[model samples]
Target: MSVLRSGSPHRPARSLATVAGILLALVSLLLGLPGTAGAAATQRAPEPRHPEQDWAGSQIARHEGTADGGAPPAAPLASVEGVDVSSHNGNVAWSTLWNSGVRFAYVKATESTSYTNPYFAQQYNGSYNAGMIRGAYHFATPDTSSGAAQAAYFVSHGGGWSKDGKTLPGALDMEYNPYGATCYGLSAAGLVNWMKDWFATYKARTGRDAVLYTSTGWWKQCTGNSAAFGAVNPLWIPRYGSSAGELPAGWGFHTIWQYTSSGPTVGDHNRFNGAMDRLRALANG
Candidate 1:
């Protein structure tokens, strides 16, 4: 799970009022108050009607097959269904997640430098204890200072993959590194070299090939023409919205298509990462 910190490349922070409301709700629940009591706290507050809507809501709606306006139900996860957990969304209740149709998770482990996730221990421990299949991800950093060191740090702090050989392999999160900008910053050849170094070191330590995660644009600009590395490791491509139907050229054989940034799960407002069975098969393979 990559820490989409306040300074991270993607989305901005949530409003203060939103944070306050969530905290208040949590506090009320902790005090053993009734559900209606918590609901009443904002009855006359003139807040947004869907005030409780958060990432978790988006996820629930997506998973319940209600996201696109009375759309048909999504395919079942009897053989393959998964989610990616990160510190940004905090720790999810393992029981709730399992019951909500999630079969596996790729939890965040480390970012650049020594910045290990605050929730890594809790999420990993809870999921593992529950016997859930899991994998780890390292936030890719091109900050010449210690890219390899950061990779090593993630592996060290995030714990190793499940030994039962059922866990998805580890991944290098190369989406939006503030230091590296995007894969565009690296020349096509440079991108290959960088991935080679990272993957080689990762496999040497974990005994599994590193799964490379990237968005469409990043893949086109950084690795579109590089057969040297792309052919060796599995690719996890992220393409949101209707355009998800259009995958990157030359990389049609991706291991995973992160079709939705929002999917249904218990406890959390919206969970991230959902893929088709074909993608799941590739991951499991």
Candidate 2:
């Protein structure tokens, strides 16, 4: 009944067509269809990550060995036997490990001042009760907190060394990152300085040089194979083979070698590079 104006009869259809075009564009974006901005965004690579879990050799085997490979079939050498354990090794049968001839152990104590192994007391005390020379280790997260702060937290928790013959010096476990970049996003110089802070602070508190745990490849790639701590810190090198392999730069010899990630009886077993007396000597000092 309305008087027609030019282009008026088609107005509703044009509006509906415009709305349909908008809806189609939105659908394309949601679907990340080709030639769309959303598609471009989707095509960008994802950031690197994993569920972070810091431990002894957590990332070492992954980066250093064949995919998911276990320790070599070769039998361990005749040396002072040891083990390194973390919270994952819950309620360790310390007596069984002792019976299996594990004379020494290093238990994960703290990580980056934020995490204290939930099984720390059980593992640390239990290992000692079974007559194994046990030490606490701190998994270094250089990117999370200052080295000094982390060191203090470690000492306050359980990473303390004593002259007690049954307790070995606390060790610092510095290896590849489990969650992010291999070097924890720190440059070689920065990482070196960070560790110096840790060493100095730990020495100041416990009057002991903390043992250093790292792989040769990581040391080279991450720290430029800096040998600054080699003269003081005992190196705990990890290589799952018949031999300990070439050590990282600066150390004349490795003190302890984590030779197997998959031990027949215990968890990960190590071999102190000497006899029981020398093991006791490390504990005493």
Candidate 3:
């Protein structure tokens, strides 16, 4: 009637309650609330969520099939391509590797405590000197005692990073190894710290950051947070399936995605790595 109170406590409380009610109404609309309000709610609701928006797993699941629903599926990522050229059997022939769509090759250099690849030195040299964009991998030393040493050994023996600054970089392979009893004993944090030490030494020697090669099990059990390693250090994730969809959500921005192990090989037993764009990027970069 006359003059309104300067600062009415009740007015503020009423305003807050009104705001809360509006928020509730909005949420109810989004959730398709029932009753007469539901019809009006639907009209003002937000757009339907994209399949890929909520979860990466869901995204992969949704896009598992070809866009046209054909039997032959398309590649998930458009940009990176890669292949692993380890000393599994023997050296990888560069010419054959290059010809078979091998863009970037991650050569296995060293393994955990006391188990080094005898062919690493020669193979690494051949790959690097032969004008191939390369990355080196140390088959993770879970035994913390020799982690730093193994890393140093890798850098010293693995031909370092490309002199021309064109290679996919280095990595620490942290998958389970059945033979190494000592390695199998360490806790997750112990394994992670060992990798950290290894990568640090490797970087110091080569002047480039090393990638962290791990599977989903290793990531969850060992590394926990994908973002814990930061954005600069590239991640090489391994998933054995038709789709790269099984990879972790935060890991969508991985540097190298090992899509398949059954890729074409070069020599009698030389298996090729996967990824076209990844290889090209490494070479060009």
Candidate 4:
């Protein structure tokens, strides 16, 4: 997501105390003492008390639901609710998320080629433990490093999928650049080339196509509206205000629609284009 965007873009903060705590735990583990990591995983992970209170009350327009728009979609909104999150969300209450009818989640795993979300394991595994279909995504930085290198970094970190029948394929968050240029200093053709490298490398390593999370505007501006990935990669479209709008060049319809960036609960709200059975099939595959 763009740093210029309106929603909580989840800017990363390096907390020395948190790092020191993790280091101490690692040292203890290496010294033959029981580690907190194991305990943290085996037990119910701590849930942020009043997590919703942390909401900045700010939301992106494209993420607003139909109530705010006051106009109905040409077709009914799809069923099967889901959410996507990053560090900006802090500790997620996976139990509450499930109880709230959140059937799935896509957590931010890695960004560019260097940064990985500190809370990836907790969010990803936690959601799975809560019985929600889970997936992970990488924030693409076409300008920072080679796309192949970044994809490798992402998979190694948390973007890899297993055949556990519950892990959704990793998604590539290729939207407006968070840095200086919207297209990250690449021409339209260059952006497409970068995407080709990234997707091919990800698929080669993971044996599954990466989901493409993008908006029509960003796709058009960066990739010159190329629909090359449309057939292979599933489209996760983001459109605000109304339920329907112009789509990116290639796909006739989106497999998943992220209706709002800001929903009643934490993270962005989304829906699968098909029924829950189809969503489950996708997850299983």
Which numbered prediction scores highest in lDDT against the true structure?
A: 2
TM-scores, in order shown?
0.62, 0.79, 0.61, 0.74
For candidate 3, write residues 206-241 as lDDT tens digits. 777777766565466545644556455666665545
Question: How does model 1 fare in lDDT?
Answer: 0.57
Residues 1-285 of candidate 4: C-alpha lDDT, one tens digit per residue:
446445666656779988888987887667755577556555774432322211111222322332443222344545688888887887899999899889999998887766777788889999999999989988777877898999999999999988887899999888765445778899988988898999999989989888898877777877888988888889987775556378888888888777766677878777778777888788767
Q: lDDT, candidate 1, residue 172?
A: 82
What is the lDDT, from 0 to 100, of the residue 48 in candidate 2?
Answer: 33
Candidate 4 segments exceeding 4 Å error: 1-78
- Candidate with the larger TM-score of 2 and 4: 2
Encode model 1's per-residue lDDT on 158-210: one tens digit a residue. Answer: 73554464466788876543432455366767766777777777777777787
TM-score, cand. 2 vs. native? 0.79
In model 4, where is the ten-residue run with the lowest total lDDT?
51-60
Q: lDDT per model, in order? A: 0.57, 0.86, 0.55, 0.77
In angstroms, the error of model 1 at 275 is: 12
For candidate 3, the lDDT comes to 0.55
Best by TM-score: 2
- Range of the 10 consecutive residues with the lowest summed lDDT in candidate 2: 66-75
Residue-level lDDT of model 2, residues 179-283, one tens digit each, is: 678898999999999999999999999999999999998999999989899999999998887778898889999999888878876568888988888889889
In model 3, which runs have C-alpha deviations exceeding 4 angstroms? Answer: 1-73, 113-115, 128-131, 180-183, 224-227, 248-252, 266-285
lDDT of 3 at 56: 12
